[model samples]
Target: MSVSVRTRALTAADGTLSHRYMALRSLMKICVKRRSVVTFLALFTLSVVLINTIPLLPKETMRLPPRDLKGSTSKRLPAGTPSTLLDLPPPLNGHKNKLFSGSSAIPFKQPLSHSVKAPVTSQAAKTLNSSNSTRLCQQKCIRDGGGHASVAVGEAEMTQQTVREVSGEETAHERKPDSFWKRRSHSFAGKESIPRDRMRGEKSDLCQISVGKWNETTPESLPWLSAGDVRKMAFLSGGVVLSKARVPGHGQVLQVGLGAGEAEAEAEAVLDHRQHCQSGSCALIKRPSDWFEVLAFHLDRVLELNRSLPSVLRNFKSKLLPYRYISGNARPVVWWDPDIQHLAEVDNDQNSFSLSWPLYQKVLQSRCGARVSLNATPCVGVQHSEWGRLALFDFLLQVNDRLDRYCCGFRPDPSDICLENLLHVKCKSPNDLLLVHILVRRADPSRLVFIDNAGRPHHPHDNLNFRLVEGIDEFPERAVSILRSGCLESMLLRSLSADRELWESRGGAEGLRPIIRTIQQRGTILLQHIQNRILRLNKDL
Candidate 1:
C-alpha cells in the first residue's frame, strides 16, 4: 500500500513541475516579442527631441550666415525728398550680362514675353521677399532637405513666380511679422501702419533666382550671393546724420557708413558755398534728388564706364528712411566693399598725367577734338584711355562734383594740380581733404572711378562742369570715338527699352520720351559743340 501511495505522490509532483516550466517558457516568449517594439519607440522619441530642440537654441556664437542672408546694408543715411519718390523693382533674374563683362554687373534675368498672370498677395511677398532676416536664415530645422516636403514648397513658389512673370501683374501687400503681431496685438505702437495693397512702390514682379541648397551637391561655380547680401550690407553709420540732418519740417538725411573723407566732405560742403551752386549760379541750397543716383548707374552701364562703384536701385519702406520714402519707395543704394577697393593713385611714374589750369579752361571753352595739351607721355600703369573713360562720361552727364578735391601730387609735376592726383580714397578719409564720388581700381589707381556720379547738373554752356576739364574744349578720344561709332544712341536706347517696366512704372512712355529725346539731343549738340571747340583750340594752339 505504501509503495503505491509514494509512487502516486511522485507522479503528481512531476506533473506540477512540467506545467510550471511550460508557463514560464510562454511568458519568456511574450517578453521577447514586446522588447523590440519598446526599443524602437524609445529611439524614435529621442530622435524627434534632438531634431527640433537642438537647432532652435541660441548659440554662444552662431556661425556667420550665408552671404545671401548677411547682405551689405545701405550706408546712406536717412534723407527726405519732395513728394517725388523713386521706386525700383527687385533685382532681375536671367542671363549673364554682356554689357560690362570686365566689371561685376548685376545681370538681370528677363521673364518670357508670353507671360501668365498670378495673384500676388501679402503672403506671396513674404514667401518671396528678399530682405527679411528670418527668411534669409531658416535652413537648420528643415528635414532631410531632399525630402518631398521641401521640394514641393520650392517648386510651388517657383511656379507661382513664373506665372506672375507671364501675367505682368505686380504690387503685393505687406504682411506684418509674427513678432510684430504678437507685440502689437491690435495696434502698432510708435508705428503708423500702411496698407500693403496701397503700399506705394509694391512690386509683385520681383522673383528670386533658382540657387540650390549649398554643399548638398557639387557646385558648378563660386556661389553668387543673393541680392539680399548686396542689398543688406552693414551700415556702419546708418541713421540720421545729426551733423547733416535737416530741421524737423525741413527734411531728413540718413547716411549709412561714412567712409574716410565723406564726413569731412559733408561738413565742408555744408559750410562751403560750393555745394549749393549749379550752372555757375549758386542757390542757398539745392533740394536733394534721386535723379543723380539711379539715373547715374544706368547711364554708367550704358556707356560701359565700369569705373563707378556698383549700385542698384532698391525699394523698401521703414522708419529708418525719411517720411517721403517710407512707403515702399525706391532709391539708389551703393555697395562699397573694402575687399574690392583700390587706391586712386598708383606709384608708377610712367603713367603720370599732367593737366594745367589753362587746359582745364580749354575743355570748358572749346568743343570736340580740341586736342587740348594731353601729352601721350607713356605712364607705366596709367593709360590716357582709362582716365579719359570716366572723364568723357562725366562730361556727358554734366558732372561738376569732383574738382580741386585731390591733394596735389603727380610725378614730375607735384607742384601742379592735376585731376590724376585725386588722392582721397573711398575707404580712407583724408585729414585735410574730402573724398567725393570716386572708386579706384584695386589693380590700378590712375583709373578714375565714376561711382555716385550723380550730382548738381549744370547748364550746357556752364564752363565749370564736365569731368576733368572745368572748361569744355574738345571731347576726349574716348567720347568722340564712342559717339562717332553711333553706339551711344543704340546702347542708351536699348538700356532704357530693356527696363521698360521700370520706366513705365516711374514714368510712362510719354513721360520718358522727353528724357530720352533730351539725351539724344544732347549727344547731337555735344558732337557739334566738340567739333566747334576742337577747331577753335587747334587754331589757338
Candidate 2:
C-alpha cells in the first residue's frame, strides 16, 4: 500500500512539474516575440539610474550659504570685475533702484551748441584707468546699487575723446576744418559782453524786412520827408526827366540831373522845388530796398536828435540811368549837398581825422571838449557831446561799418561786406583797426554829418553792435530819456507814419508793429545796461 501511495504521489508530482514546465515554455515564447521593447525599457532604466547617480554642480559650489531673501546682503562684486559671472536671481533687494527703473542715468546726446565737458566722477575715472574691458566696467557699475552708472562712464569716455580732438591733441586726419562763419560764430562767446535779457520776446520779425509796391508814391508814402524835402523827392521821382547817371565816390548812389535840353527848365522849375534843393538842383538815387536810409533819417529826427541827410522814398524810371539802378521798385532819393566836406576815395583814410581802436579809446579817456588840454590831439576836433550822440545812434541802428569796421562787436557772416572783404582779420591787432565813414561838413567841424544813413534794420537784437559804445562812459541824457519813456513804440509809429511810402511799404501798421517791438525790446535791454553801468561807476567812485 505504501509503494502504491508513493507511486501515485510521484505521478502527481510529475504531472504538476510537467504543467509548470508547459506554463514556463508558453511565457518564454511570448517574451521572445516582444524582446525589442523589453530590451529598450531595460536600457532606459539603466540610463536613468546613471543620471541620478551623477551631480550637476561641484560639491563645494552646491554647499553655498543660503541667501536671506527677507533682508540680508550678499557678497558684492569686486571693483572692475564682471557681474555676469554669477546668475542673478530675481532682484530680492527690498528697495527698487530708481535709476534702473526703465530710465537711463544720463542723456546720451546733447546739442553741440550747449554741450560742455563731462564732469569726471571718481568711479568713472577709476573705470577709465582700469585695464578691464568696457563690458566689465559696465557690469561692475550695474552691481553697485543698480544705479545705471554705465551710461555716465560711456559718456565721459566719449566726451574726453571729443575734448582731446578739439584741443588739438588728436591727429589732423581725425578732424575736419571748420568753416569761417562757424569759427566766427563760436568765437562770439555766446553771451554779449554787455548785459542782455535772459528771456527774449517773440522773434516773429527779428531779422525780417518789409516789402512793398515799388511804385507807390503819394504824400502819405513820403511821410519822412519835410514839405520841402518831399517836393524835391517828387521832382526827382517824376517831375523832370533825369540825365547824366554818374556813380558817387563813397556809395552806390547815382547822381541824376536835368539834361542840357532841360537846363533852362531847371532854372524855370517850380520856384518852391528850387528853394528845396539849392545844390545844383541834383539828387542822389539809391536802390529801392535801401529803406534803411529813410529809416535812419526818421530815427535821427525822433531819437538821437542827430543831423542826418534827408532821404525820401520815390520811384520813377529814366532812360539816362542804368537798368541795374532801376528795378521799377521805389528807391530812396536824397538831395545833393555839394558844400558838405568829405575825404575823397583816393585818400588812404577817408575820414577827415584818422582814428584807430586804441586811439579812439585814448580820445574817449581824454574827454577832449569837456576839459581843454593841449595833448587832446585828434580828440580836439570832435565835441565831447558829439561822441555820445554818435555812439548812441550807431548802437541803435547797429551801423558797425562806421565804428566797428572790423565787426568786432557781433558775429559776422560772409554776407557782411566787412567779413566778406576780409576786414575782420584786422581785428586781431586792435591798434591797426581803423574807423571808417566818419564824416564832417566843411561849414562846421564841431558836428558830424551822417551821410551813409543806410542802417541795418534786420540786425539781430542779441548780436547788436555794442562795441560801438565800448569806450563811451557816458550816454546822451536825452536819448536815454527817450528810451525810458516807454512810448518809443508809439513815437516810432507816429514818426514812421509821416512817410506815406515807408508806412505802406512795410505792410502798414501791422507789419511795422513787429519791427517796432524788436526795437522796443532792445531799448529795454539798453536801459538795464545803463543802470548797471551807472551803479558800477558809482561804486568805483
Candidate 3:
C-alpha cells in the first residue's frame, strides 16, 4: 500500500508541473500578441509629457536676479505727485468759484469809428505808404500808454483820407480848370472828421489792447507763470517776432560755417552742394528737443555741430555724444559699383536676410578705414522661403522708415545691386552668429535682460560669451539646422551655458526633473494597463 501511495504522489506532482509549463507558454504567446500595443501606448504617453514640458523650460541659463521671489514681500507705495497743491486747480466748488464770479468781472467794450479825416501834408502821405507805418504808430501808442492812442489812430486814418484829398489837391496844384465848388465838395467829403475817441477805440479794437498795471497783491505775483500769463507775454512781444520768416525758394541752401572736423566738413559739403538740407547747418546754434526735431533737422548736421561747438552751444548735447547714440535704428547705406554690370541682379524675394550693424561695422573698420567710401558692391544671401523673404523685407522697411524719419538727407535707393554671393562668402561660420547676438546686445541690452513678475531686475550679465559646436560652418544656419535635426537637448545645453544661474533661479532644473519623473511614472502606468489587458485576453482564451 505504501508503494502505491508513492507512485500516485509522483504522478500528481508531474501533472502539476506540466500544468505550470502550459500556463507559462500561454502567457508568453499573449505577451507577443500585445507587445506592439503596449509599446505604442508607452511612446504616446512619453510624447505627450515632452510636448507639455517644452514651454516650461527656462530659456536663460546664466545670470541671476538681485533678489529671489520665493517669499512674500511688502507692496510698494504709489509714487507721490511732484507738483505743488497751489499749482493744481482748486478742489471742485472751492475758492476759484468765488474769485471768478461773473458779475464782478468788468467788460471793456471798444467803440467804433465812422468817417476818417485827410492828412494836411504830402510828406505825411508818403510816410503812410511804407510797410512800417502801422508798426511805428503802434509803438508810439504803446509808449504813451493810451496817451497817444488817438494820435496813432489819426495818423493811420489820415493816410486813407490823404488818397481822397489827393484827387482834389492834384487839380488845385496843377491849376486845373475845375470849379472851386467841385473841389470844395471833394474837400468836404475828405475832411469829414470822426471823433478821436471813436478812431482810437477802432484802431485798438483790432489788437484788443489792454493797459493795466498789476499790483503787488495780484495773482501775477505768484512765482510761476500760468498759461494765460505766457500768452500775454507772447502777445506783448509783438506779432512780428512770433511769425515764421518766409524764405524765397523751396530748395534753397543755407550755408553754415562749422568748426573744422571730418563730420563738420562732410556736413558743410552736404549743405554747400544744396543736397537736401535734411539736416540743416551743422553750425546752427539752435538745438532741437526730440526725435521729430532731429529728423526734421538731420543727424549728420547735428553730429557736425556737436563736434564743432561747446556743450552749451550744441543742440541736443546729450544725444550727440559718440557712445550715447544707439545704432540699430540707423538705416543701412547700401553702395554698389555700377561697373559690376555682369553680376546678375539678386532677387531679394528668394532669400532670408538679416543685418548685424556691429558685425558690418567691424568688417568695415577692419577692411576699410573709418572714412572708407561705402560705394563698394554689397553681396546679400537670403533663404529661399516666403517667411524668410517677408522677414527680410520687414527689416528693410523698418530701416528705411527710420532713416527717412531720423537720418538727415539719407535717401535709400530701392534698385541697388545686392551682393548675394558676398553674404554667402562672408557669413560662413558659427562665429558669425555670436557676432550678431553681440551686436544686438550692444544695440539694445534691455531686450535680452530678464524681468521678474513684479517688474524687477532678474538677470544681470556684464557681457555674454557663446560656445559653438565643432564642425559647424555658419552659426545662424547651424542653429536653425540643429533645431530641425531633433537635437533640442544639445541646442538647449549650448544656450544654457551662456547664463546657467538664470535657469537655476527660475526653477528650470526642478521643472525638468518633474517632467522626467512624470515620463517614468507614465511608463509604469502603461505597463500596468498592458498587464491588465493581457489578463483579460487570457481569461477569454
Tell me, by TM-score, which candidate is best. Answer: 2
* Tens digits of lDDT, candidate 3, 111-209: 212212332334343334333434443453344133232232233333332111111111111112221111111211222332222222223322222
Model 2 lDDT per residue over 1-541, tens place:
9999999999999999999999999999899978978999999999999899977662110111111221122222222211011111122124221111211111122113422222222544333333233344334323322213213322233222211001101001111221111110011111112111100011111101112332343444432334654555455445454444455354667766532336655665444443434555677778776777887776775563546876677765655567876666778877676556655556643577677878877777666765555245757477655676787677777778788878876889788888888888888898889887676777777777776767677787656766776766555544554453333554455556656767777776567766666555555455444433431110000
Error of 1 at 20 (Å): 99
Candidate of highest lDDT: 2
Candidate 1, residue 521: the lDDT equals: 38
Looking at candidate 2, the ten consecutive residues that score lowest on lDDT are 164-173
lDDT of 1 by residue, 182-265 (tens): 111111111112222222112111111112332222111211222332232222112222122232222433333222244544
Candidate 1 TM-score, C-alpha based: 0.34
Error of 3 at 233 (Å): 16
Ranking by TM-score: 2, 1, 3
For residue 104, model 3's alpha carbon misses the true position, in angstroms, by 56
Whole-model lDDT, candidate 2?
A: 0.51
lDDT ranking, best first: 2, 1, 3
Q: Using alpha carbons, what is the TM-score of model 3?
A: 0.13
Query: What are the models' TM-scores?
Result: 0.34, 0.53, 0.13
Question: What residue runs in model 3 are displaced by over 4 Å at the alpha carbon?
Answer: 1-188, 191-197, 209-273, 278-541
